[model samples]
Target: MTDLIEPDALLFNPFMPGFFEDPYPQYKMLRDEDPVQNHPLGFWFVSRFDDVSALLKAGLSVEVGNLAPGVMMDQLDSLGIEDGKHGVLNMSMLDRDPPDHTRLRSLVTKVFTRRAVAALEPKIVALVDAVLDRMAEKGSFDLVEELAFPLPFAVISEMLGMPPTDHARIRELSGTLVRSLEVVTDEEVARAIVNADIELAAITRDLIEWKRANPGDDLLTALIAAEHEGQVLNGDELVAQVVLLYVAGHETTVNLIANGVNALLRNPDQLALLRERPDLAGNAVEEFLRYDSPVQQTRRITTAPYTLRDKEIPAGTFVLACLGSANRDERFFGADAGELRIDRPEARHQVSFGAGPHHCLGAALARLEGQVAVSRLVQRFPDLAFDGQLEWNGRINLRGPAKFPVRAT
Candidate 1:
């Protein structure tokens, strides 16, 4: 594909108006025009399905420390940020490369397997039904508030055996901290992210000590007990992992349920079809992920010179793998790639949870949660429809509605 944006013309400006509410058009432009976009900011973006898929499993470096002096790093430095200062964010497996990522992922992979998630199915079903029961009485409610957010939040809290606290505070902190994953260019936003990470880290530290003292049959307790190579996860590592869980555990599923339902409502034909064929629940979740991925883009810093489509990308180059675009690529998903088809066979091929080494550990859990939550809601509420205007979450990386009002008879 030929680059569309001329030199001095920015190929990707995430701040482009209306980009957040619906990034698909922009993503399509990138995929069709500059499949391997070299941004003026000194980084690259791979939007085509084949390239994005290959890049994820290419064994490239994910560690920011491996990045050469570039625009992103310079921006961070200008924000008065010191290296290794964001301990809670920096130490997680999400940012690690190779051996460290492997070690950290190994510690928790067993708990998120298909069979493990199956064991938790009853709990998920019960949770979904319970929320639906409450919504049943109201007849109309904000789906995001009443179900989407709380279900995953409560599930993760229960899984970790966390004590009751201010749920709103945690939600607020979690939302703020997610901006760390985006391209933060504002000074105030950067400071807010740094502050939020610190506060959340403190809360996690206290939670860890409490869990250590009062261990039980839960993920946190299990992490406390887990050992690798005769060495247990230390203080900093423990905090990072727990925080990562708290965020990833709920964030991904919340988007799935909310975005999935929103998609169904928008495409009434598909929604009616889903209502008729509830068996498509599992496949429906995959379509939801592909139609509108929760986590849109993932980054990797090249540890060595890499060549793609005849262009040689040098070592230490930062690359943003556009997962959302790849999921919608016409070359891979056929001519109607833009449309939401619930039964699409290639839906599961979407790279929403990503692929390769850092693919989301909580994917199976998220899928199960989404399948149950979305399926039961449609089944329970025969007249499910939009109640009011939808509000986008204003995030470029994680796309979902902030407020999803719906009414059902």
Candidate 2:
């Protein structure tokens, strides 16, 4: 590979701060000209919807953690932190391959079924109303803080049997963990690792111990008691599962709600349509996920040499599936690909939640949260408008607003 072209031109440096401010342009260029661009760093960038979808469905790969540990190790090294033995948070069923993945997913699938998620709807609605009530009194607010952040926190917290008082503490810790996702200088990385380690260890240990002793009627307790006759989650496995659920369950939903709201704010006509027809809220959330997904990109590695779209990707090459870009590819989505339209017939087909076996476990929970949060917010504040310049979180893989100030009438 005689260094085909400038790495910068083919693969955008997502670690850079400027990329976060605007990745769409870079993504558009890649999708148009280099759908399978080879990067100098020995990875293939897949930006088209069909190509990315095919790769995901192909399933001839390992999870990003095992395959491209450097992706994470480099992140950890940059932060001056010694990585722990990779555990469940990094090894959920979603992260594992075939047999193991199948077993692990089967064990946890019962807990997140549509019926189970539906049971939480009433509670979710209550949480949304309570948050909106407070925000209504203020007349203006940051939706991320006042509504988007806490709604999912409450829903997931209760599901895991955590107390409401711990919501603030857990939310703070989750924020710190998410910040660690941004590729930053060693100093910042060190701070993030220390913060994440302390908070995650303390919270996971405390909750696991409590669930062990008290034996509550919550997901944590159930996971603790779950077994396959002789097989069960070991101490570390149990802890990792809790940590995974805590982080994935809430962090992504936070982005979904925030990103969804930001999408509506940016598209006033769409916002008006949603305001007038709350029935479209569900479909609209799907479109929002496609337009600005919470998880922007995911990595995969080839098990052996493979040819894709006329390019040969060797073993050990990291494949970056730019989901955010793929969702807007004109070939799959047509001319209005980038536009936010609830009426679009193909909006539901977006790969925002991903495809294949690793599709988000909490997709149902996220959808419920998004629908309720957006519908109620729009209904309560029909005149909601952006009140200040939006500040985006500088994270490569997560697309969301850091601060979305809005005025509600």
Candidate 3:
């Protein structure tokens, strides 16, 4: 569709229908024609692999406070996203710069270490089986509803030792809250996000208070007890971290399983390969991450003048490091970068979980979940196939299928 139009106006427009469903074509154009795009909106788009990698680890600031007075702030201001709104979005370590980021991340990093994640293998296997068993009962089902969505939600809830509550309501609130991370031109959506954040924060506070009364051997309890230099996470900090963990813990992995299954089914050979060799489950998850990243882009504010190739992004500018594009860069991943090869040697190097200081803390856990979920899925139902039309979730940042109808038998 963009083959005839000017690339500058429409190229990175996630609203475009074709680009929303399949963004690779536009991504390829950006990489080929303009690897570093200086958007008119006071932001820079870095599409190349090396440049993206550099930008991520270039000591850039994730905090919006570092952004110089610019159109970006005006954009946010226009949407009514002021200081007090979007509470968890602002407070989480994902939005913090160093010292604070280091401190906040360290509080829960050990829980997601390789050893910790590995120890959850048996539990993960059981959980996956539990969901798959339900799927088996219904010969055909929506993959998202049946297996992909519920598994991670259960795991995260269990890890946090959350009391049994209304799952549907929380999922609704979370789905709305995450929209804050994506492109929001609609004031309605912006307000909805703010409202969701408020509601979710209230729910989280109540949960934290409940945990305070009845402590347990779980992450929420640990966060409640965590201290650094005699300073514990105060009320707001505790709420922010717990909310971040709850949202990030399940949402991305939901996309991972759904997207991984979508990719494998689309590539019959890869699905067959996974079925033939179950041992490839772990590595296959990495390849799946590379093939179609659940999280497409991560943003950072330039702290200093950042030069990439020949382009120098000025300090305090918003730079969108396109991880999805970088993962498929031909220059780095070879000529078949667009193709899915489960055994691809460089698959593990994909920046789907990102790199540097703000790299995803739940990478190990997500990998384990994806490995188990995807591997057991195809193995259990050898004839697994897409049963109906697929619908892309209209989210630019966390892009995946919203409706994934599939045959389990």
Candidate 4:
């Protein structure tokens, strides 16, 4: 396959079918040939492990989101679009810089603490069991639809104290919004994204009102009352925060479990190793994160001129930190980086959940969900294996099987 492609071809061509199915080969080429290549479309692609790690630690100097004013405006112009969506975009700390980001994160931290997350273990376990039971009834199932998607979606929704009656609607809306991140050439996706954003905004607004009237011991209720320095989140802020949680919490863990299961099935040795020592479940989860990262790449805009790998990147430039490529970079994980090894000592060093202040806020919850789901699947179904052709989600940024058929004996 490597022989068929041009030696200098950049792996980021969204339309390239070969790159979408298996991008690691192209990523390896980028790491070796041009670790810090700037895209003609206007962004720096950082593929090497060391370079990605350094950029992550750069903190607020490198902000998240492609909508940063200068280059982002240029991008919009190039697309023949007008204006920006700051109202909705600013709500997510994942896309904000310091001050606003810090304040929003602090407000959210009051509710989404480690203890709060830890307390959900039993609930998560039960949810996992319930999901598996449904899968068992079928004997054969789409692991993603039955277990991966539902488990985390249910857990996160319950944590938010959303009414059970609205769970299906919220889940559907969140899925639509997340799918907007895919590399689609059609205007249908764009229209869907815009509509989903509008619908999510309305749904969250109503949820906030409901929580205000009937407060419960849930994250949403806590978020409603949460304040820092006597400053509380406004209505828009509240809606945005809820939407952020819904989007982030839903997709990442779904892909994590789905991707992890696929990795385990593909690497029988590691699966056997995990099956023998279930104690390695935690370590194995980390490897799954590194092996097939849920969130492939994250955007960071340069606030100031920054030097990375001897290349001086100017301010306002959008830099894509390729977490997927970095995770497989041979320099960090050694020559056997391409292979899945559950016992890899340095697997935790992976930036799958990212690093520094702007790192994923729901990392703890996602990790817990991944650990329980993957471990339970291995233990309960001793002969678990792929039952049919795997269907990739076809998203360049979020890689996972859309329909992973598996047989559990």
Candidate 5:
């Protein structure tokens, strides 16, 4: 007779420390057993590649925040969730749906186009080189702190015409602000987010006024001038979008460089292959994204009833599509889903950048950054390897190393 299953075995929760350390095995189990598992927290977790893809591509889908179907500010007040005593969230395009999302995205689409991102490649390479030179002097460093974190922050800030001196302050504000997305459920964290938001708003207001007066060639000035059908982003929208872009740009690319390096270190053979064939750096990035994505999951709300694997989900139900799990599904990626293959043929198939109308706007920039960072790191330190134990960031929504110590031996 088959072994009896535990009732709680099917429940998938990623909040635990153990899950942060390693979530793949559990992800596999979820994909194999309950591809459309429902969580006790009142959301469906979709793990299979096909199902996750379908749900994300669903035209009637709404932002996860809309799942509650009421004024979010009222909910925040009821829960005492004072995230920096600000009303910024409601003004954010990231949390909006339909006409609002369409309008906001259109305002900045020109700025994020592939051609625009390509024009910034020379600057990105110079920034990467400067960091690598500093690492070469020490012959060792915390990869995340010294290289991964600062590089993207510097690039994004430069694009906004932010002075290099203000980069550190912006980083601090961004770090605290992003936590609201991942840890808003915790009361203590909610308050920290509030402080960050207050500080961020002050800084952003100053910058907006400066850009308005100066009207330089930077992205901030360009955004200030950009309009769609003669409709431009208001002051609030501009600040919200700038904050979103600055934070989102750093968060993912930082993780990508750190996570991609960590993955290469773990798989020696793949590392060696990359060292020998630097041309594969582009493909290797895709593989790294597939193996351990930066963004683990994205939430959406059903606008209409939907069915998956015989499970019926009602309208307004929050759904969490497990992007990390779906990327490793054996059916789509073949049996070697767990291994790091630099030349994996279908690496681009991974949904690390997400999909559909709301797909990541910075996807191309992220790819270029990853390819350059990884390729140059291998070239700079052929003998690079772990210098100490790796530290997981403990973020349930985003996956990456908190501190990755490496030696340039």
Candidate 6:
């Protein structure tokens, strides 16, 4: 006879701050004990790799019509997104299902092709070298603030055609917007929403005006010139797209670099392997993505009742896929699943960039940035070691070190 799960085992509360400190244990328990557990806060938590992968690949269909304003409101409130419906429009690619998603994604997909990203390798290496040169003189550095955060931010800023002078301003705005994503309380969420709306809207409007008057051979200019079947995006759409690329491109990459560096410091032998064989940078980036994904969780709502692993999920139910847990699931990754093995044979199968239609649009850029950043850091500072205790940003959805102090030898 099969073992029976208790009614209490069906729920897992993720809101607890303790989970943010070390959620892997809770995630393991959830995966082993209840793969399809529901939360009292009104969402089903899918922890196992297979279950989460199935739901992402097949269960809940993605359609713009199914994009609930309430769900967006909750997400926005959590992230402190304040441009109201305008922000939602910019995120249409992620929110919409096929046809719409297919149409929209095609427009910008060419810009991020593998060849394009590969071409950027030399430029990225140069940038990383420059940043490290400055850091070497200091002998001590905060990786997140000095290198990881700025490198990707600078790259995206250049791609968007933003002037170097405005990089600091853009970074500030992006930081605020990203923090808004983690604000849990209603009051804090409301404040974040208002701040983002006023600031981002103004920034977007200014950029649009500048792009119209002073066109350059850059992504923004390309976006402005882009026309599809005699249809062109208006100023609003252009601004939204720019903001989306600017924030999403750098914010997640920042975490990936920081998290990857931290993981390497914890594993000396793996760090040594990466430092010696920089060619492994590519696989190392994939391993980092799988080992500790920047994006920890993402949600989808069920439009129709579905049976997943014998558990009945009613229509309109919200499902949270714990990617962090799923990535480390032993069932998919053998016994030593938690270890950070740079040569892990099956690392590519991880869903850190997600799967199906809604896969991260910036996946190519992220990988390029990660490989460049990680390889260069090890090469630049051969004796780099943790200088102090790391401080992590207390966020459930986003996983990354807030500050990573290191001493260069």
lDDT by residue (1-409, candidate 4, tens digit) is: 2333354566455455576568888788889988998766566789999999889888835444444322232233344433544236445777667787888889898889999999999999999988888777788999988999988888888999987557777777776777544433455555555566777787787777787899899998888777434566654877888898987887889999999999989889888999999999998888999989999987777878989978999988878889999999999999999999999999999999888778889999999999999999888888998999999887778788888899985
List candidate 3 stretches off by more than 4 Å.
Answer: 1-10, 65-86, 110-112
Indicate the worst ten consecutive residues by lDDT in candidate 2.
66-75
Model 2 reaches what TM-score against the true structure?
0.90
Residue 353 lDDT, candidate 5, scale 0-100 = 79
Expressed as tens digits, the lDDT of each residue in 1-409 for candidate 3 is 2343355564566755687689998898889988998865567788888988988887789886424222232354566555664456578889888788887888777444577667778999999898888889999999999888898899889888899988898999999988766656665676677678878988998898898899897888777777433474554887888889899988899999999999999999988988898888888889889889999998888778888988888877878889999999999999999999998889999999989999898888898899889988888998898899999898888888899999866
- lDDT order of candidates, best first? 1, 3, 4, 5, 2, 6
lDDT of 6 by residue, 1-409 (tens): 0022233343455454466667787788888888897655556789889988888886365542323222244454556343444443335466556565676677667555677667777888899998899889999989998988889988887777775456666677676666544323455544554466457757777886787798886777777667433354543555666777888888789889999998999999999999888878889998998888898887677888977898998988767788999999999998888899998879989898878667888888898899888888898788999999898877667788887899995
Tell me the TM-score of each prediction against the true structure: 0.93, 0.90, 0.93, 0.91, 0.92, 0.88
- For candidate 6, the 10 contiguous residues with the lowest summed lDDT are 1-10
Tens digit of per-residue lDDT, candidate 5, span 348-409: 99998777877888888888889988899888898998999999988766778988999995
- Candidate 4 segments whose C-alpha is farther than 4 A from its true place: 1-8, 60-87, 179-187, 227-229
* Better lDDT candidate (2, 3): 3
Residue 355, candidate 2: C-alpha displacement in angstroms: 0.6
**Model 5: C-alpha RMSD to truth?**
3.9
User: Which pairs clash inside model 6?
Assistant: 62-97, 78-181, 79-180, 79-181, 80-180
lDDT of candidate model 2 versus the reference = 0.76
Model 1 CA deviation exceeding 4 Å by range: 1-10, 66-86, 227-229
Between prediction 3 and prediction 4, the one with superior lDDT is 3
lDDT (10s digit) by residue, model 2, range 1-409: 2133354555556653366777887889888888898866556789999998988887866565534422343344455444553323455564568777776676677665778788999999988988888888899899888888778877888888864456666667766665444333345554655556456766787777777887777887777667534375544655656777788787888888998888888888988999888889989988988888898887677888877888888887778888999998989999889889987878899998888877778888999999999988888887898999888877778778889899986
N/CA/C clash count, model 6: 5
Which candidate should be chosen as best, given lDDT against the real structure?
A: 1
For model 4, the run of ten residues with the poorest summed lDDT: 68-77
- Kindly list the per-residue Cα lDDT of model 1 for residues 1-409, writing each as its tens digit: 1233353343766766787788888888887778898876678989999999999999898887525222233355567665555547778999988688887888877554567667788998999999899999999999999999999998889888898877888889989888877766666776777778878888888898888888888888777777433475665898999899999988778899999999999999998999899999989999999999999988989878999897888988889898889999999999999999999999989999988889888888898889999999999998999988999999878889999999986
